[model samples]
Target: MAGSLGPGSGWTAAVRRLLRQFSSAQRPGSPGFQGLPLLVEGQQVGLVVPAVARELRAFPNVFVEVTGGLELRGGHCPEERTEAVAGVLAQLRAEGRLARLARWRDEAYEVRPSFGAPALLNVERAAAPLLGVLQFGAHLNAFVCRQDDETGSWQIFMWLARRSPHKATYPGLLDNLAAGGISAGLGVKETMVKESWEEARVPPKLAAQAQPVGCLSFTYEEMDGEEFGAVVRECLFIFDLEVPEDFTPQVGDGEAQEFYLWPLNKVREAVNSGSFKPNCALVVVDFLFRHGLLHPDHEPLYPELMAVMHQTL
Candidate 1:
């Protein structure tokens, strides 16, 4: 979710407005670097820069070589570049410059020059908190939805999780039933299966039944103290898991406080009312449209909304 907080009304109306706004637009406003160059050995290999890291250019040690965009130079190869960047981040952390940054995990995410290709380098996930801030590449999202048959027929209901207050990012906000970043070592399905258990406590037999339902790609910028103007270029690997009617999600690892089974109408109300995290709302919109709940006759911006949902990163 980007730059949304508190509560608002007109859930459905808000959805319409967002559809019209994002679909009609191509890029975010000038807040942070659109695509900062990630240079290695004076050659442009990739892109990565914070949307709003105030001291990006004032690093005391790591050299900033500017050409067309903010360039990180000095490392002889990709691995060397990564070490150099990590060193800078370690220094920042030591100086208390990353209070708002997520807890340092010493984990690395692969930075690719393009989609579905070999990575140019591996960078600390904390350094490029925003997906495209360092323009590393794609982060995966898993959206969990279920079928509601309480009305006698198979109707749709969403299982939404309330993020734990302890979370460093978007704590206590609404989130998908089971979601996480696709870490460097995990494959897509492996990630989905792991999160299903770790976040929602879905049993293996039930989790194995989960199905892939395509993906939603989008880029968003947020205004926050830690990551101002951060751009997230993400591809959500949406999944649909039909749990037994009586199943209730229990918090497995404290990522979520609890889970709620929401009727489709209530889901719509929450979305319009801004009760859901911003990006989660986008996932819900795609689910609704895919299930034929959002139609052209009712939503004048239906086509545009769909277009934005499937935009190429």
Candidate 2:
């Protein structure tokens, strides 16, 4: 597939831009004060400033004492703090303070001090608007891709899932075969398997065969509401699964509308056509590179693109 796609193609540029935006080396040059310090167990996690954080401080469910930075304490343990924040977000949703933001999964994800190892605390996925403002390192994405060599020419096809129209964010967008956030109390592989079953109806046996490819990290400022917004720092754990040629993915959950198996050219077209979610588009580009479907000589900026994509989080 090397040199099959010409350099300077619009899709190639789009893919390159996606890779650059998500890389830490291309960090946004913003004033430091835009984000508030997020502290868990007295340690800094991220910076957030969603209105919900102010509400969190005002709510009595969780102890919010501000000594140097905003801290989630007064709860006996991390669970307590998590419960307190979830409750607060739920109430805000009910009161209409948070509208579409509430449509995210209700599950909680573990927020770590940095990348891996020890976890600091857990928070609701929807409440990420609040935490995202703090730029907490809790947000994570697990992407599952299926590789098919049915063409018998060593050609590859990837299975893609279309998001449900009812989804709050990126509704009806194309996504990976199975993708989800790494919820609190769930490991990367665990979340991948769970999402695989829920989103693609993949049998546990099949899901278990998935292998971790690598991780992509990026931080972007996002507006959660008209009045509230936060800088979001996220890491996506990418995985690849080799599947039988005849295998088809069914939607077990309402999260996705349907699944489609697309060839490399079609995948590239869909990604550059703006049919896929921004993050998913990036994942697809990474997929192309890892699978050797996209070659270094295909693009003039190949070296720069690969360098940014391969940078360690």
Candidate 3:
């Protein structure tokens, strides 16, 4: 697989240019800033630092960027309900003690029942479902891969599990062209195709040609646990696949969100100290460190976490 990738085989500058504009601007929530919640439809939550709130009072929720844009931030992603969100936020600020913008991050939550039913609560104090069936988990681990005379970055494709969409993530499959190589660099075997066609509208060719990598996780809790106080084992999976460096996700995947790669240093630091998606710190960071992604300079920064992974994983 490494040999097939020759000179000038990677992400285009256009892709880098697009990701930089946003990745550069948005750091995770500041540790010093307290999160204030703005009420949403039925009290759903979003976060804003005080400085962010003050700045927000001035502009609309979305905007255009110097490069890749159509920005929806400060309590809004384009996928979110726009006017409803704005109204709820306005009302929350007016009624409740101005919340420190609660964010609906995919991690860090409490499980308990108030009215005798299981529910998941984020730090923002909003509720969502639990006890669900998900297809699988996918992994994205960035690495600094280099060839002589050409030192560059590569997010290596790792692995994936089989299930189905009509049933689970990938239904009865293994040894596809996408992942077999990295794990053992063999080649295509009996494998499944991409769900892009089923979910978003990406071309089948794209999915077929697209390699599956590490885990893209789907995790949830059972509401019964909150009411019954039962212990559920934490669940997770690791998917490994590959994609063209310049590939842009089609709208088929339920994920309307965007991803931009940052410098390895910046991503490592933010994932360590900042309030990023909790799973990242929980899973990705440990994997990267165990795999030698962090620099010597960074190891000292998160010595305890580093040490833990070094010992555990």
Candidate 4:
């Protein structure tokens, strides 16, 4: 794998370009792109673009425009703040103010100053990006290992899921073995187990074997066809689950249409071909780096790739 991924590899440019796509959030002081900080209880939690801010201004009792940013207004407690913001979001959805709100999940995501901090509030999953709040999720890289008879070495095969065509976002795109948002009140492992079962029929006991790996984070702008848009800041908690050679994942909740156990090379090819969902491609790149498929000695942009994938959010 390392040999195939050297400096002159044809896929190098594609992989580099994909990483840049997710890390494309405009930096502070960039001309023509400015996002107002969304604060809660005096703590900055998200960034609201001008258009959304204007829409939010309609609900003065809920959204407060301050000197340089916007603030969520209500009682200090998380529940109160959540209720206050949720009502406004639901109203906006009903009015068709933002296009992305059409895919409301009714699921809540904890808004925090930072990961592991006490929750500032719980906002609907669809509203997290709109509010520019930090969103957390778990992704599992399920693989099987087998002994290569001729080379007398081990080989890895990864399981890739084709998302259901009926999905609201990224329908029919390739995804990690199982991935899901860390909804309010659920820990990383718990979400992993739930997603593993829902997207693929990995049993609780098998899913429990997943090992907690590092994370990938990025802040990118997502715009609707109209003026409404979002600054999406996201962190994905990654996990690796090694399954038995004979274990075949069955579709559990229809989130995934089917699964494929592809060799590591094939997985890399798919990632380079832009077949995997954007973020999932980053996860796979991280996987390759961890498993020695991508190495600094061979890949010219190794250091930059590593830094960009783990950007601070």
Error of 4 at 93 (Å): 0.8
For residue 72, what is the lDDT in candidate 1? 60
Per-residue lDDT tens digits for candidate 3, residues 176-285, read 11221011111121222333343334355655544333332222222222231111122223332345455443333333222344443444444334324333344545
TM-score of 2: 0.81
CA lDDT, every prediction? 0.63, 0.67, 0.31, 0.88
Best by TM-score: 4
**Taking the tens digit of each residue's C-alpha lDDT, what string does model 2 give over 272-305?**
7789888778778777777676676666667766
Predicted structure 3, TM vs. truth: 0.32
Q: What is the per-residue lDDT of model 1 for residues 160-277, given as tens digits with 9 covering 90 to 100?
A: 8898998877788888888766667677777777888898888767776777788877655444474543445666777777677778889999989998887677777877877776
Q: Cα lDDT of model 2 overall? A: 0.67
TM-score, cand. 4: 0.96
Q: What are the models' TM-scores?
A: 0.79, 0.81, 0.32, 0.96
Scored against the true structure, residue 94 in model 3 reaches a CA lDDT of 55
Model 4 CA lDDT for position 298: 81
Candidate 2 segments whose C-alpha is farther than 4 A from its true place: 1-4, 16-33, 50-68, 133-153, 303-313
Cα displacement (angstroms), candidate 3, residue 46, comes to 31
RMSD after Cα superposition, model 4: 1.6
